[model samples]
Target chain A: MDKRMSIDEVVERIPNGATVAIGGSSISRKPMALVRALARSDRRDLTVIVDVGGPDVDLLLGTGRVAEVIYAFVGFEVLGLAPHFRRARQSQAIRFQEWTEYTVMAGLDAKIKRIPFMPTHATLGTDVLRVNPSFREINDPFGEETLVAVPALKPDVALIHVNYADIQGNGVILGDGHVDVLCAKAAKETFMSCERILSSEELQRFGRDVQILRVYSRGVVEIPWGAHPTGCAPDYRTDLRHLQDYLKAASSEEGWRQYESEFVDVDHPQYLTNHGGPEELVSRLKV
Target chain B: MPLMSEFSVDEVIITTMARQLKGEVLVSSVTAFGSLAAHLAKRLYAPDLAVLSTPESGMDVTPMPTLTLGQFLTDVQQGIPLTMEDIFDAIFTDHFRIWINPSQIDQYGNTNITCIGDWSRPKVALVGARGIPEDTSHLSETFYYILNHSPRSVVQHVDFRSGAGNGESRQHLGPHGAPTTLVTDLGVFDFRGPQGQMTIKSLHPGVSLEEVQERTGFPIGGGEGDILSTPPPTADDIRLIREADPLEVRKLELMSGPMAAEKFVNIYERERQTLHATYPRVGKLGRG
Candidate 1:
């Protein structure tokens, strides 16, 4: 793999109207630099897909780049509702479709297997399966009517964030890995941002299983403080402060741009240090 | 008109009405029927206290008098015998939870959560027993909210029962008890009916026989020809629940009228567009 490119070089690679898939649940382990870059790009008409809903969904939804979002739950749990997704759905501002939690995961699995659609009974009988034509219930080999027919969701590009990677795009997640690994495997193109770039020997110290470099990754960027409030591998604690600010900005379009202008469009990642340290980052991002 | 305590439907109404009766009871208000129940509760019976849980939190929003679950658990560990009143206060004191009903609940009135798919090889998979386990197994009193009635939700046999208040899960629950009542848009229902088959208790005002049939999945058991309209909530119900909590009350108002619900969704969309525009992902490395 090529050595890590400057943040601006990475920013120039991403264009408008891309169907991008983000890894991690909610705000955990999201590619911070990519998110910053996207926010700075000011592109629109984006289609995004995530497993379970979270603030990452909120950020894009709030920014107006997302023309469509597909997921299961959007609300904060039930405090009120996914006020953002709810309001959007109510007004037809963006297209809304929901899949059972399993189907969404399995869809990625299906993509990994290189299948158009995988058959498994997931959301059968419920309104969720019946409403979506893309999903179907087919009989198994035994002629038994079971299995939810789930179409694969192969994203055009996947933005993955992790703990570490080599200059060659080899990476490590150091935890459950969830769907992040699967996202990398399925996406046609992948941009992996890591906390640091490890030498081949340092990566060897972690052992072979720890590394995730393969045909899937195209570029690797060393973003030491990339995850920020979001959790990094080995080190616990997500960037709650930045997440809070993201939530607040995401709650409204005007508020989102103000946030975007400050954190996303910086000339360099070092500006993150001067614009105030971690404390400022957290406080400013908190809604 | 019969008081809410008299019929199955009344029991459902009372669950919400009791909240109003007490001054203010928490209602989930997720679906159309739930919103109606909360609206009625706010109108007729007002509760003294109410709380709301966000989606960020779990869907189960029963509140305890104390702060966190750990605190209550600690109190229990210290030989503090938790009382029915303590549990009821916790559940009754909350705003609402989104619930799903099942076809043919089991002996203890527990609903089905298991699926045809085994852990390994499975035909169909479901979100088995999501909240039913906690809501029925632990909560003092649980509300079984059903939006549409069909053999699916109201049936002779449930494929798998998760939370048992009286029957199988009963052994599991030991003392936590089970559902307090079942509320449907058509009418309130009671699991106390013959063989624990739900029986109709009361009907909402302006509801007709045809409307009830259209909404139900089971054969109507009770509230025969003599059924009467459920009493509408008084003005006090509105002032306390609706006017009192702006965030929750606003949602209640939005659900009050279909047109209003639609309007709320419209405003929600414009905001979504704005968010997406602000955080556009750049080139997005990918094969596509």
Candidate 2:
């Protein structure tokens, strides 16, 4: 079965008011192309779960498509606070469900394992338990202690980016998977976009620990420079200059409109061209 | 900007944090200003502190002021990549010391980063439960380096439980101990009592024990009514911080306003570039 789909078709499957878990490290390996496509689409009222939120949350909030954000921390790292996210937060325009890095990790892990909830000692005596009803303290029948139970987060979809993948959906990431692999397993469906799509033989040559098997992938989009602005390790570095510009432009509604028009409104080819072509990105990868 | 006639409040806070790390080798997890205090402590006092500013920043000997992908790649280039996967051993096995800022803390040292009021509907929404939750119950040791020393922050009970402490730690954290030290703008607190409860260790210079009690939401424990003046930052501490942060980026950590968050981001970018050039990459990754 050919599990290959266009970016639009993959994004089209995500309905309005759906919950999505995005896979990436802060300032790295983000599915920028897919995020942009979703922003430009008619989708609305999205609920996002990310460990460290950056432009993914910022853009959706900027476009007024996001209704809530579930996050551990949300910042652009050195690039600064995510402008749209910060404003929305200050204005109380959206609801926020805060989880610790581990809570989100364990929540997704439980979902993947098809468990109702996972037991953890985290957030047991902390202030986090007061607000989130999803996290409950239950007696560890086996361990003789009370622990926090993190309910499974079975997201509707998981939008992920990897360095290399095959049309069949098997993929390889050059760097740390973080909770990306877990997100893929937790979601009902996972759509991947890769920098380069290799054959099954090629994926086998590179081998395990680095590979994400086709079994987890529902569909794969072979889009080069898919994780633009933010980077894919070994493939390219973060487009820092463009990101700085985004930080400034996203601070205001007017500035974000210009950014939204020039960058987000266009399709993949035009988007790559507007970013000074794939060749320019290739040149920026000296590090 | 607290109008320090003789010395600023950070001097005492940073010194206390550095002093805690003295004579110990620790793998620490910190963010923003806490990283600075930990770095300074390692540079001047600890000498065996490994700070994981970011997973990509890995376990660098001397943590850089700004953590960038370039710096991360360089660190990765220097040795095998120390990614999030590596954190398992660091947190559970090797036991990384934790340095964090809690929005709300109770008498037992239980922390809450989730929200301020009721959990269902919060009065104020701050950063969510992150590292403190899991690490609080698992890490070898935990420390709170908070800036706000007010009733709103030092509460009788935290609205949410983000990191476990006190009897809760004994129940949930297992063999990994609970928090031992707390360094705030008001004073240094020690939890090494018969029962693990926060007590005023020493008041900052010019601060009265009464002032601390007046601000704290809970009944002040341990020191009772008589706590000594915390030793002010030595000349070396002040000199090291000044030389390290010429623009005083440390001031941003103290700001309470919304606009300060924006300015902090801008300042961070500008400072990161300049500071990355000078960050001392001391010995190898494993050595620290």
Candidate 3:
């Protein structure tokens, strides 16, 4: 009856080569604990669906757990490129499907709506038609105009981190959650890591719009500071210094290994201790 | 004294980009280095301009420098925000113009941010077509900024079509306009030449017409037609820019070779303001 599990336990359920989508925008509020767990594990050949992804994609790509990346863009926000992802792409070690925000959203909407495909004008005049075969161009039935029909994206699993969740797996998203809701709705299996494990009644204190409900989520875990370094807005700010350090470390193999060892090699409990645990983050929360 | 003298390449490009935003568009959005130019335009010339400051920043009343994701969060914390849906809808509405940076631009005005080789696969992988599809094909006006211009970037045919220009595949595509201006380190280019291929509207101060053609992957401005050149930025423009981008973080993205000894003073003074008080000295430089 209880859906709560440890970070490692939830990640263990994801098989190698699974197509997974991680929530949050670019560098903001990523599911870093779950991501770190996946990286630490022996999972291989993952295809990550991401928009505005930073370390979520870069860390997995660096660890060689990724086979492909589906992204609108993946860079270090403004600190330049995602070093590990860029290195892998330059060597052709990775495969990617370049998409716009609309194409990816449309793809997810198809699965959420249980439709075969979603038609959009996003790729009508662009080279996305040629670059990605995942979408097909067909003439509109009512008119002569060309419309692109993007295939549905039903990832094998979704790894999302939210600010709050109940033991039964309802989640509370705090800020500008770009496509996380659609991602959860579209994903076949959804695993979440949250800052707090609240009661179903406590979740009601939030207005109806924030919660992602138990039906869409498969499992949830309570891991304080779970999305550290990456901002969990309405909670702690993005640890800029930590992100900068990671950026520097990721630029080289030796540095990345050191960073991975320092952060990812440990369990969620141990990792939380290194980052001043839950108390420090509690005071920083905007709410 | 000449109003247009003793300005750096960075200032010229900034002014050129700022002027491009001068027309009647109520809102302007720019990505990467283009945002700094947009910021300057709002302060200096286009006081009425509303900027979608960062990539995530939609219509904000104030122009805060959100050069990073962290700053973007700050904007959201303090400002009235736009949802991802609203931002995308605005692209189709045609009220605002977008200024984007392209990895490769073809003669017909098509741009590519997809992989540099065969679609099946090969060569360098660039940042995929994020907004190029919507911005290039749907927005009212779209301009481009190329930091490093060379034969590889200005090509005959892009390896994969990320943004549609005036190519054969886009002939029937309507409601999509070609880019208004293609500003680069070398010069400002447009698609006014025969058959809508790129041609030189104006060459930069130090650059030559022959050099531009030689470096271009496709032919431009020669048999196509006579090329025109515009005057460089005035001293007043330089002062405005120096005050605007006090941090001179943009210099890293645009400055080539060296500016004279005096240009160093502006860069140092502005950078110091951030290094000392705004942020820890080490944190402020690349942080912006």
Which number leads on lDDT? Answer: 2
lDDT of 1 by residue, A121-156 (tens): 334334344345578766687774555578998787
Q: Write the per-residue lDDT of candidate 1 for residues B139-252, one digit (tens) a residue.
A: 455667554455566555455454454543443234444556665556666666554556666667657767766555556667577876555544454344333232332232
Q: lDDT by residue for model 2 over A1-287, one digit each (tens)? A: 57899999988899999999999866778888899999999899899999867778778888888998888876676555566766666667888777778788888988888888988776665656655657888898986888788998879999999978888888887655657888888888899999877777666665653457778889999888888788676566667667777877876778888999999999999998987887876765323
Q: Which model, 1 or 3, shows the larger TM-score?
A: 3
> Ignoring the other chain, what TM-score does chain B have in each prediction?
0.52, 0.83, 0.79
Q: For model 1, what is the C-alpha lDDT against the true structure?
A: 0.51
Q: Which DockQ value does candidate 2 get?
A: 0.35
Candidate 1, residue A222: how far the Cα is off, in Å: 1.1
The lDDT for every candidate, in the order shown, is 0.51, 0.73, 0.72
The TM-score obtained for chain B of candidate 2 when compared with the true chain B: 0.83
Give DockQ: model 1: 0.04
Candidate 3 per-residue lDDT, tens place, B1-288, comes to 233357777777878888878644445443435666676677677776667644544454444343332233333334455456666777777656667777788888888876678655546666667777877657756788787788889888888778878757466567365666898888998877667778788877767877888888987863345555656777677787776556665655554323422343344334334423443322111233
lDDT of 3 by residue, A81-140 (tens): 677777777777878787787778888888989998988777766767766758888888
Model 2 over residues B1-288: C-alpha lDDT tens digits? Answer: 123555677766877777777544345444556656777788777786766545534465455444333334333344334655466546655346756778888888888765566655556545556677767767666778788889988888887777787865565556464877888988888776566878878878778877888999987776665667777777788887777666566676676444664665466456544534554333221242
- Ranked candidates, highest lDDT first: 2, 3, 1
Clashes of each: 86, 14, 2
RMSD of each: 14.6, 5.7, 6.0
